[model samples]
Target: MPQRRRNNRVAVSGATGFIGRALSNFLESNGYEVIRLKRQHFKSKKSQLRTLLKGCSVVINLAGAPIAARKWTPNYKKEILNSRINTTGVLVDAIKEMEPKPELFISASAVGIYDSYEVHDEFSTSYATDFLGTVCQAWEAEACKVQRIKDVRLCIVRLGVVLGNEGGAFPKMLRPFKLGLGAKLGDGHQVFPYIHLNDVLNAFWYIIQHETSSGIYNLVAPQMLSNLEITEAIKQRTKKSILPVIPEKILRMLLGEGANALLIGQKVVPDRLEKDGFTFEFPTIEAVLDDLIC
Candidate 1:
């Protein structure tokens, strides 16, 4: 059985970002008392952070700088890595001190941990060593520390590209296609691992509701998609012509190491979530374009 209504408080870091705002709204609408954890909270002393978390039933860490926001300069790459690991490290400390620790801690990660062009599930052991991969590895490593706290379950969600019209890469992605200028990226073979934004929110809710739902989960749609298929779908849906293919060499020059993120993708699936009976709201690219583009 779940706890009393008074104990239904939840603290969420990164409560200002795209996914965070959506989740905060969802939880509040469902009667959850949400305490938004901010960057300033992580900067304070560990005990100070704990006071903010008092009486909370859950703590979700989605606090991090945008991945593809800027070119991955050596200094900027450091910023990306520290943003995730540092916020997560502080949360781990604060959670360690909670007398009645939150029932669960779900930290945000990414599918970039797996090598590009390979199929992966929660059980895949073949990890990548690139900048994005190492960042996720370190980010999850910090969250893993919470497993040491007795009775508090730890869940790390490896997110793919979350598709929504309002925010994330989806809106920017649509602009080019809408103008009839969309093109195949790289060799047009990289997988486009993605999921609907609503499903991302529900996946978090599902974990909180299911007591036995613990450990890592790939919060991606089950269908494996490639760049060509996605491009063709967008073209057909919008009744637009395909633009000239953008050479990977040009992309690499423009984005630096960040191009790897755009040109390579993991074939990830939400295996654990499906086995646990979670249903996806949007599972196919066509369904996604239909709901989003129309």
Candidate 2:
């Protein structure tokens, strides 16, 4: 493998978010200068955004409103789309105007873009028509605009559920299982694609370091598990008895449209990532659970 340039500058939007915070720390610790771009910067003026991004070798855009943060009301849904698309649009436009453009442009997408049933890889064309799927599609579309710029390697990472000790769904998941109320969500048939926090950071760093690494890549573990499979894994790890399954109707009633996130999921695999030789620190749900639990 080629050695990364010492002091290679990288500008990252959404640096305060869960993945962004971790990524920024990882880059800095590895001798890369990371500039955190705020939403306010994009809202200010293009010149300011350009000035902030200028001279950086890599640009990572992860700006998006939290989908699971609140009820998916009409206004909140609009906020989610606008946050991702608008921020990405600003970055893409700024990249176009940059003198010496960043070598690599990496943006975020979600596996929710794929339909619920069957396995999906980078090559699969089937996409969901729901709210999240539409959001992911539009987010990627804005990111694809960077391709028009000459010599810029564009990589769109379709993220799976990110599991980590801090900040992600992992912390919330621990609450139920810890209380011995661990149970499958919905029918437990929907395949959930997930990745460890370590792998997520490594994938971003891997793409930036390897000049040839570009295009859409699924940032997920090779082992795709159904909800029942994951629940069982948690049960084994915690040594706790499983409770009754939570019905989809209950989740829907509580979360509204956001329940689709838990009820419907894609069986996404990181084929390109593995083919590219990126190793996972936590390859299986068992491994992930053990690391985080016992």
**lDDT scores of the candidates, listed in order:** 0.89, 0.90
Residue-wise C-alpha lDDT for candidate 2, range 41-117, written one tens digit per residue: 98897898888887998899999998787788899899999999999999999999998888889999999999987
lDDT of 1: 0.89
Q: State the local distance difference test value for candidate 2.
A: 0.90
Residue 287 Cα positional deviation in candidate 1, in Å, after optimal superposition: 1.3
Compared to the true structure, candidate 1 yields what TM-score? 0.96
Stretches > 4 Å off in candidate 1: 1-6
lDDT by residue (tens digit), candidate 1, 1-294: 544433679999999999999999999999898999888888777877899999988899999999988888998998899999999988888888888888889999999999875679899978888889999999999999999999898999999999998788998888888898899998889998999998999999888887788899999988898988888888899898878798999888888999999998898989999988889888888778889987
Quick one: best TM-score, which candidate? 2
Pairs in clash, predicted candidate 1: none
TM-score (C-alpha) between model 2 and the true structure: 0.97
Instruction: Give the poorly placed runs of model 2, Cα more than 4 Å off.
Output: 3-7
